[model samples]
Target chain A: MENPYLPYPVRIDEIITETEDKNLKTYKLVFLNTDDEEKFIFQAGQFAELSIAGQGEIPIGIASSPSEKGFLKFTVNKVGRVTTHLHNMTVGDIMGVRGPLGNYYPWDRMEGKNVVIIGGGFAFTTLRSSIIYMLHPKNRSRFKDIHVIYGARTPGMLLYRDELTEWEKRDDIYMHITVDATDDPDWKYHIGFVPTITDQKAPEGNADTYAIVCGPPIMIKFTQPVLDKLKYSHENIIMSLEMRMKCGIGICGRCNIGTEYVCKDGPVFTLDQLNRMPKEY
Target chain B: MNVIKIDKKTWTEGIGRLQGFYRLIGPVKDGDFYQFKALEKGESPDFSMLNTRLSPKSIIYPQSEVMFEYSLDETRDDCHVIKEIQVEYSPQVVFGIRPCDAKAFLLVQRNFETPEYKDPYWIRLYETTALIGLACNTPCSTCFCVDAGSGPFNDAGLDILLIDAGEYYYARVNTAKGEKILKDSGWSEETETKDAELAIENLKQAAENRITARISTDRLKEKGVPDLFNAPFWEDVAFACINCGTCTYVCPTCWCFDIQDEVRGTDGVRMRNWDSCMYPLFTLHGSGHNPRDAKTKRLRQRFMHKLKYYVDKYNDGIQCVGCGRCINLCPVNIDIRKICEAMNGFEPEQKSI
Candidate 1:
């Protein structure tokens, strides 16, 4: 059997700082071996374990769409050792990546249905991938109206600013950006928390509508009720959770909440599924 | 199945003959307790003890095992490439093992050898090992293996089961490996006496009957996850736990691990070490959030995973084999039997302040 622990080598082709504090950076990586690239097919909302060989490995959500061929993108926040080491690296520096792990959003099931995406702070990476995938020319006609409600603590903390600007001009999707509170003169978006903005701007929930939400624990805890009040069934409100993981193959045993191994069973779950699991995560 | 008898005087000679063909491992005196270790030449297992302090899981899944080795020397053509270290998988015998400990390996195998992924290191080691279990003639005060899907003479995972018959040993061979070892050892004296088999069965029943302890697992699966998560008794259960990680390390079924890369100048080895859920660092996220940060949460996780979650997931009784190593080794005297009964009997409708 192939060793799941061994990571394939990749090199950074481009790096984009997404936040003012320079805490978050989006790296565009190209696999050193073309065979690895061909084998690493992934869907939106799935994650991969990025490693620095000596430093360690950490799970990061894949931030680019599967439709975008050739390169893979990961938006990493400089929170711990591995990310700090990765942030210090420049283009051409080698790193290791293993996966396309965990279950992804149910995109195939949402075909011809209205899509509602709620994102908060740096947690928007996977949602960004989903948006890009749903908006792609080949996939656009399969989905109906797309509504995006995204927010950050401040205007400067928002990620993918250029893409947000481009998305705001697109006629195919509706985009609403916000900040908790901002005084920047260039700020042209609403100023409030995600749940409040979601309550006011999100489309009325229906049987044909599917909602995907990702954020910090507090944001998710509060957003669930807002989605509930909007009449979204527990089965339709999807969420992506964050947990400390190792092996990403489900053997190390840290990401278990009840009997579910988040690395293998999910980083994504429906509200109905979450209701059945222990609240450890 | 085959039954053979070996006189007490010839047991050492039989072991000596087997050692010539395979490496021998068994329990031996270690300070104040017994431990499973590789037997040197002329050494015999000390079968006087009820059980070993630490489990024999390390034989198959070592506490720290190297998975890959790589060199950083740029001049070498294979530099920076990780090569799997060649491991010796010669046939070996784990003699004088407790039946419960042997059964624990089968439970752990469910995690390591799944259809989607198999741990080559663990699988390879397990495949080459033949377990020779010593039936418990004297049940310990803490032993509850009878309640955990195993018993004094359970032959679920053992290749051979040896019962002490005072003046001699009655060995029951359960597999081809066991028969081969017995035949090679030249101890294959067939016992045609029906009284010997009757005596072994009587002794097994008496030993099992001596174990008066039991834990209720009847209601564990019926309880809701949230009710158990929010149970008010967690603080009481977690109060005495110091998070020493002794229980996990000594457990026969606990299989959590942490992987790290070790570098010594030009060479690097990626290794995995045994990790415990009792530690705060086990679930610490890179983003400064820990889901099981509090001691109560960590303590709750351990029990819930073993008694409730494992039962629900595998539909196999529980993750615990009930060897009672944790009960014996715990500094605070935290008993799993009590916790299991508490969880199994927990009523969500009754609120406790």
Candidate 2:
């Protein structure tokens, strides 16, 4: 019986300020022990509890793909006390990461299908993980096609700028990056909300296609209809939910939408699954 | 399945003997009501009360438990590293517990000891303790254990069931743990199996007959969740609730918690405290978005979770064991039985032109 509450120690390797407001930062962490890294097996769309010594723990999506070896990445928003402490900490500072918690994207069902990623603003962390995962050379051949419709309030608020730029030049994956109302003259991408771009650029739904959507509730709420209008069935739309979580193993009991504990049974659910549950979330 | 007859004169001696081998906890009169507390040396568990005010769940999952301790001094060897603290899992006995309260542990154990993950703190304490239940000879006004998959003499959760026989007690050993306790306490007065069974059955029937409250759960499993969630009666149910959180605190099946860090200079301990859904902060997100923002939503969540969600998830009857602690302790007189009836009988309103 292993202790699920115990967190593995990691040291902050690098921190990158993501947005213009300085509210979001991507922290690259390396495990203090090689054994800990070997034990931390995770997939895209899963999350972890980032623990601070005297401040509390917060559940954040794991932004790094497992294909990228050596370190784990978490793009944390400076909204609460623990995250604010993490934002103020310097490199080489030690912290705790306690997961690989929650379910991940349906890669088993998603094999040999087109993946359309719809994301907006700060909710793009795990989407970034999924994109990087699908783009890896060894993994690219397993999927048919990849299309991304991502947006932010402005060009300055978009995350993973360097990766998005490099992805734009790739012929293998179709990338349609957009900003709500950007005035930057150098911006060559689309100019609209995610739902609008998704409507215009997303592939027509078929049995061979699946869409993974993660974003603000407003973005998800609006993107759902566009995907539906494109003839995507309820089972093909995958979503990640947000809830205030304590013990990521589901014992804490606060993150339930219905009988399902989002920390254990989900964070990832198909629209078909969510339809059967209460709309409280 | 062993029955031993113990005289009332030797009950205190047996308790004192058991105390030497294990930590003893049971209901004792505190101020105006009874509560479960650890018995000190030479102290015996008082067994005359109908029920305790607070549940004995705190014995397994303490209200506030420290999980880890750390030092922020940077000069210390374990600086900045949150290390799991050493916890004691000593053998214990909960003597004279109600059958309903003991049954709550079984319902709550499903959450902590799931197939995927197990809570070491809760599991360890629960496994090491022996539950000695005192069968209800007189049912309380608020008690409705029969409808909740439990009864006055329910042995589902207890290791041993003790039947009060006026001048003596019939200790019906239900598990290996119960037998061990009897052996350790040196109580070897054996009773006829058929005779003890007949006597216990008669007592159980009379006590159950005294319960008049009925909770209908037949339609709870079949009701549309969205219709129940959006029911108009929720407003009436939540109208008087002050969100004081007394209902959750006194509930044995409510297991939600909040983790925090308390600091004393350079030393700190990370602990988890009991949290309530009745509070606005329970479901509030870090991004200033709260799904359960209003008290109506929170109140709905509490009932839906206990009566509907738990029923659907485990296909067990309900998360509650019908202990009636919440009914007795709630300041606003909110009753779960009434809410359960509304949900079980709810039908969506029809739209008209």
Candidate 3:
């Protein structure tokens, strides 16, 4: 039997400071063993425990799409001890990545449906992965129309700026980028909160359209009403929950919401499912 | 099943002979209280005590266990690489364990050995240790095992169930492991199968009838999850909880843990220690958000997990064996029996105009 607590060794290949504040940095890691790399099959919206020796481990979402190969990417915010230690490390530093833990977004249900990706602030990591995954040439035909409404506190705080620009030029997918309030006169994007932009630009929700929302609690709380007003059924709205987790495989028992272990049963649950559970998270 | 009639005089000799084959862990007297500890040379288990202060869960899952060890020194060939620690999973015999504590293992097993993922650490240790249960002829006043899906003489998780009948022990071997241990211990005095079976049944019935305290769990499965979660009686039920985590520590089914890395210079070991839901840090998010922030919320979670959540998830009995260690140890006298009664009888109030 595989030891669920054990982590696979990975060496840091590159590190990119994503936002201007330098709180967020994306690490590109390569598995030390070829066999280990082959074993790590993952999907968008799933997270992994990044193990830093002598420090600890933190659960971070996998920011890289499965279609993108040879390396795994994790966009970490330098908030706690393990992340702080991660920020000070240099390239080629060896650490460990424990999983492709937690369930992914409902891809089986989303297939052949129009996907509306709504994201805000630093939570755009997995959304970026989803956007890249859907835009892949092989996967592009799996879905119909794709719309993305991404927002941030400021223009500098937006993640994957270069990729956003490239995506904006593509006619295959729609990109509506916004900021809370930016004073920069050179900024060309819309100025509004994510919910406002989502209300203005997202496609009319129906049985055929699914909106996957990932953001801070405030953003999610406000955006839900907008999606509901837009005729989105409870089941059509997908969300990813945040919780303090250890043993990402769910045995450690801290990340539970009701009987469901967020690390195993979810991190991704629909609004319909959330309504049945305690509003604890 | 192998039935043996061993005189009380030979019991110590049998245990001593078996100690050479397996590590002996049993309840030993410890200054007005009994504790489960490894038997040193010439030591034997004291069966006079009702039960140990703490559950024998530590024998399978320790209070703190090292998962891996590593070195931070770059001079070494394997610097920064975490390696799995060498754990000695030697065969062990937990002798004289109460039947209620033995049954607690079965409840905890569902969490560790699920269909999708099996916990390697828990499964390995549990598989190696054979439980030798001493049927509780006289249960404690706080014990409510009868209604909590376990009985004083429950043999759900035991390899052997030993019943003291006057001068000899009626050994009921329930598994091959039990028979092997009994045979290897040089205890081969056979008893008539009919006589042994009848005596065990009578002892089991009398012992069960001695338990007067009872808690209702029949209605627990029928209660809705959200209705029970938002019940109004939680305030009174959780009023005296000081969040000391004593209830969770003494609970055999409370298998929650927290993992951390401890460092001494260049050497580091990643270990997991028993964690409780009552602690504020248990659910505090990194971004300064706490879902279960209040004392009432934390207290509610512990009961909800054990009573409502476990019932909803497994559809089995609650995640408890009615060991009553928590009841005996709680400084505030926070009783699970009362909380279970409230939950079992909970009904949402009708809104008035």
Candidate 4:
């Protein structure tokens, strides 16, 4: 039996700093072994544990679409010991990754439905993956209209600016970008918090609409009510959770809200499911 | 279906004979309390005690176990490659373990050997060991095993069940492993009549009758999750808790663990250590957010996971084996029996918010 805890080595091929503070960087990793690449298939909302061996390991959501093959991408924030070590690495440095763990977003459930994605800060990684997946030419016709509401604390903190710019130019989807308050003359997007912009810009919810929200806990706490006021039922609103995880597998008991292990049962759950779980998370 | 009798006078001889075939482990006096340890050349188990301070789980699932080892020597051809450390699985017998402790292994096995994933380290050790349970002829004041799906003489998870019958030990061999141990020990004496079986049954009944404590778990499943999470009694129950990990460390069925990597010079080993939910760090996120940071929430998580979550998830009884180690060892004397009864009997009030 293969050890689930063993991490496969991968080399960083490219690194892009997404924030002005240089705290968040997107790394494109190519597995050292081709067999590992063939075995690592994951959906948008799933996460992987990135490690620096002697330092430690931390769970980071996959930031690139699975439809784009050959390499994996992770957007990391330099917050703790592991992340600080990860952010200091260059293009050729090798790191460890163990994953494709946890359940993904309910893409099949949202097929042919009008989709709305709401994101804030660095929490936009998985939501970005989902949006890119849905907009891919091969899968484009499967869904109806798509809308995105993303924000950060300031213009300097906004991630994937180039991609957001490209997305804004496209006629296929509606993209609403914002910041809490910004003085940048080049800032051409809306200016407000995520919840306020979500209420003002997001399409009114209906039975055919599926809204997926991902952000800080405070953003999620405030966004749920806006969606509810927009007449979104518990079943139609989806969100991805963030929890401290060790083993991406279900064995480590830290990520459980009730009986459910977030690493296994979800990083993604419907608002209806969240309503049934304890408020600990 | 084999029955053997070993006289008290020749018990050492029986142990000596078994030592030739397998490594022996049993409860022995450790300082002021008793703990399960590997028996040495002349050590014998003290069966006079009701239960050991800690369960015999470490014999199979050790508190800190190494899973993989790697070297970072630059000149070596296979340097930096993580290789599994080969563990030798030798046949061993855990002798004189209480019936409740033996039964706890079966409950823990459900988590370690699940359908989707099998923990190789835990499974390998578990498969190579044989459990020889000693029937509890004298129940402790805190024992409630009878109300928790295991009685004083429960044979659900034991390979062999031994009852002290005054002059000799009356052993009921339940598995092929148990039969082999008896056959190889050279301590067998056929039962001449049904007298031994009748005496064992009467002793089991008497032992169970001494247990006056009971906990109601039937209503736990019927209660709503939100109601249980927002119960008013949590603050009162958790008031005295000092956040010490004694309960989880001494628990028979608490299986939570944390993985860590240790490096020394050029060599490194990845290991897992027993972690408790009572610690605030257990659920602390990397971004400085802790969901169960409060003492009341941590206390609720411990009991809720044991009494409510495990019951709902496995569709079985509570995760506790009712060995009462936590009750006996808690510095603050936070009794699980009282807390369980409070949870089981709670009637939720509608949230005004």
Instruction: Sort by lDDT, best first.
Output: 3, 2, 1, 4
Off by over 4 Å in 4: B74-80, B192-195, B351-353
Question: What tier of docking accuracy does candidate 3 attain?
Answer: medium
Which pairs of residues have clashing backbones in candidate 3? none
| Steric clashes per prediction | 0, 0, 0, 0
TM-score between model 4 and native:
0.96
Residue-level lDDT of model 2, residues B1-353, one tens digit each, is 88899888888888889988999998899998989999998888888899988889999899999988999998876688989888778899999889998899999999889899988888999999999999999989999999998999999889999999899899999999999999888777999989988999999999999999889888899877777887899999999999999999999889989888999999999998999999989989988988899999899999999999888888878888898989988889999999999999998895211
Q: Candidate 1: which pairs clash?
A: none
TM-score per candidate: 0.96, 0.98, 0.99, 0.96
lDDT of 3 by residue, B1-353 (tens): 76788898898889889989999999999999999999997899999999999999999999999989999999997898889988778999999988888888998999899998999889999999999999899999999988888888777899998999989998889999999899888987999999888998898899888889999999998888888888898898788889999999999889999999999999999999999999999999999999999989999999999999999899988988898999999999999999999999988785211
DockQ order of candidates, top first: 3, 2, 4, 1
| lDDT (10s digit) by residue, model 3, range A133-203 | 99999999999999999999999999999999999999999999999998899999889999999999999
DockQ per model, Cα: 0.55, 0.69, 0.72, 0.58
RMSD of 1: 2.1
Model 1 regions lying over 4 Å from their true place: B73-83, B193-196, B350-353
Q: Could you give the CAPRI-style class of model 2?
A: medium
* Best-fitting candidate, scored by TM-score: 3
Least accurate stretch of 10 residues (summed lDDT) in model 4 chain B? B74-83
**lDDT for model 4:** 0.88
Candidate 2 chain B, which ten residues in sequence have the lowest lDDT sum? B344-353
